[model samples]
Target: MVSHERENHFVISTRSYQADVCGKHLITHKPAIHECYGKGCDRMFPTISGMFIHLESGTCPSKITLKDVNAVVAMYTHHNSIIHSDYNKSLAAMLNREDPPDGFPFHCPGFTPGSLCGKRFELFSGLLQHCESRACNHTFGQDDGGLLSFLHKVLYSESALFKLGRLKANVYSRIELVFPEVLRDGEQEHLEALLILLQMLFRKLLDIIENVQSRLKAAISKHINYQILGLSLGHPSNLDAITGRRGDLSALAGEYASITGNEGRIAGPERMNTSEVFVWNIDTGECQLLHLFLEETTAVFEILSLETQPQ
Candidate 1:
């Protein structure tokens, strides 16, 4: 005896069912019946009496109520706040201490296992000073070790999230191929929401890649500029000695040129080939022929020291 409005809320309504009231419309000689109103409970029966019997039997699936969703969100929010606050307090306490004594090596707080450069500082102040460099754009407590640990605990370690990450690439590809077929007869609103979510995920991934690429490009450019500047100031007398070792230098320079698409050549006093090398002595304000062989892939520099020990 339920009205059409009540029936609409309890069961999925269609255009054919609009003309009929009490949700007892006949479909192919069998009476079309209402489904259970509970979330995820889709059992149907030809008669209201039969539907009621099933509800009373307590075999229906457990409904996910709004209260349950709210409780989980609140619990996670509170936990995140507590952990973030404690980490911030500890960082502030560590930064307040006086600098370590001279000659004592102090490990830089920003240097984590994941950092590209594993550089240490001679003093606490030096470590703090190194943090100012853009190349080492890392924070002490917030980013050094805390962010990854927190993400591992909350996301990576979670079974569902880990599986989602692993399968996301394949899922996206499959969805691209099958989405139109699967959603052809589906609700327009649901399809639109799914599309929007997919677009957002793709855009976020693109943004992360773009950011990393830009930082890498800048670092490479800076390193090359420094190398070129050092070569420009080398003594002319050492040019012959450097030219003799051109094969080693050319190999290193060719690799750099290939990666950056920039000509790696010396343009000082006279243009030198890739095989020529240059060395600058900071202490004596002089440039000598070191004939250094640089391995581009590993970035290891082999220097042939020309200093003669007092006999």
Candidate 2:
């Protein structure tokens, strides 16, 4: 078999076989081996990228969403060059935005009903079908600069900030695992002040929260007419027990509500995940829990600096 084989021939092994005719081969590799810990998928990979790519491709039984992949990629501080930095911000915006519009709003450019490839279509899909028909030598697939490729580019650039604008962002890491560094008792003295600072910050935040909570509690008790005061599962994601409906805060919107013609860009409670805790604002009386954690600050204008922008 070796004697009859092509010079660079190498057999790629997996649970399923790939024909040499198509490019299913894993190109990036390393000397170290790693295993896919996904359920029933113990397939070994030559590099971490290979494992993530396999899982993200939906080939593994344990399916990982592309968004989850992007989230992890954004975590690596060194990967600011290739990957999207504001992944969270963009996703929050997209999720808040209405789903993609349906049907063609405008006519197909550079084509008409009288041309050799002239079948006018009002329905958006009818035009896609025409493109895929290849009568006009335009295809929806991997054809050079076609509809699919162009949309992929748009999603790449707009939806996320991949500098190259290529889809399927994977993270390459130098360290396999992290363990805390050990320090002797004498050496730990230098870190005591930092630990004390964290404790002070937590205590300060607690005091502010308690004061605000007391005010809100008193108001809720005084205003018995408004129903959302003590609703369980008040979050928009889960159904409320008494109401048997997703708790929509927007129900409170009234004639005084500020109208901005631009919609979908404004974040809502619906964007909050099950794992996050929402913080209320005492001044605005509105919940803007868009960030993972609430940051309450008392910085004066005189103290303003680049580092104090979060305030």
Candidate 3:
């Protein structure tokens, strides 16, 4: 084969010469059908995946990058299986480096029946062994460099950190998260108990909030008019001291508005410089406290109730 290649042939058919060049044929034996829509790159390929390889290999005259292709692909929800976003920046940086770090993230993004998918490995080689042994079915490495192209783009652009493409996950996948081993030696055991207790507290807080919301909802349904009987002489001068102390109060006010036929929505929250949001205000000395009550549906004197009872 070397001697045959030593002498150049003058073949009449350009196609035959290329076919028998006995060299690397980047193009497949399949028919040319996948036409690239890239600028100045109207060349066709046997398959769409081949065209992607061409684009990502940085050989196309169009100069369209892998990140460019990935960004566009992510906009299409149906193609999510072939794309990823909000990826692990640390892993991407390691992959883009010439001499990669010793450790892998060691997470398998798979969950097949009885498979060692979604399992974390203690060592980089352990991860390789897991994939090689068909645990998670070689989930990370089986994409024909389709997955590596994602990280390789980091060499050219920083946006590569959050976006990856040509990787597969289960059709019904959870929100992709990078649950790293953020603790050092001995930290896990010490912190895990406190973390568990914190989680329980969070559950209790959630339950209390749920109960509060339920009671508020029930109160609104009862159609009872609420009246502030009167204020003590020593009552805090401003509503900020008592009424608006809680962060949820504004949201509660919005709920009140929504139930009382007020359709206004708050905008320009970014402009707020103060802690309290006052719907209406006057000179500091002229302020007064009022109460809210349901207008009786049957009463003729549904006179807007603005009873300011100050003691």
Could you give candidate 1's per-residue lDDT for residues 1-311 as a string of tens digits? Answer: 24533554575444343322222233223454655433335677654334433433434442212222212212232323222332333332222221222342334333334665435543322443344332354443424235323322222112121112222222123222112222223333443344344333333333232343343345434222211111232223533432222223334434434432353222222332323233333433443222221121111111100001122
In each prediction, how many residue pairs overlap at the backbone (N, C-alpha, C within less than 3 A)? 1, 0, 0
When summed lDDT is taken over every stretch of 10 residues in candidate 2, the lowest stretch is 166-175
User: Which candidate number has the best lDDT?
Assistant: 3
What does candidate 2's lDDT look like per residue over 1-311, in tens digits? 23222344664444433322222232231344666634335688764445555655545543332343443323323323322333334433322222222332213333323564434443333445444333354333535444333332232222222111110010110111111255444333433332233223332233233343343345433222222211121122321322312221222121102210122121223332322323333322334332321111211001111112232
Q: How many backbone clashes does candidate 2 have?
A: 0
Candidate 3: residue pairs that collide: none
Cα-based lDDT for every prediction: 0.30, 0.30, 0.33
**What TM-score would each prediction reach against the true structure?**
0.15, 0.22, 0.22
| Residue 57 Cα positional deviation in candidate 2, in Å, after optimal superposition | 1.4
lDDT per residue (tens digit) for residues 1-311 in model 3:
33343454433332333321332232234588857644345688765556656765546554444444444333222323432222334333333221322343345555556763565543333443444344344444424334433323222222211111100010111111112344345433433333233223222233223344343334433222212112111222432332222333334334434433343222222332212211112211212111111111101011101111121
Give the clashing pairs for model 1: 246-275
User: TM-score for model 2?
Assistant: 0.22
The lDDT of model 3 is 0.33
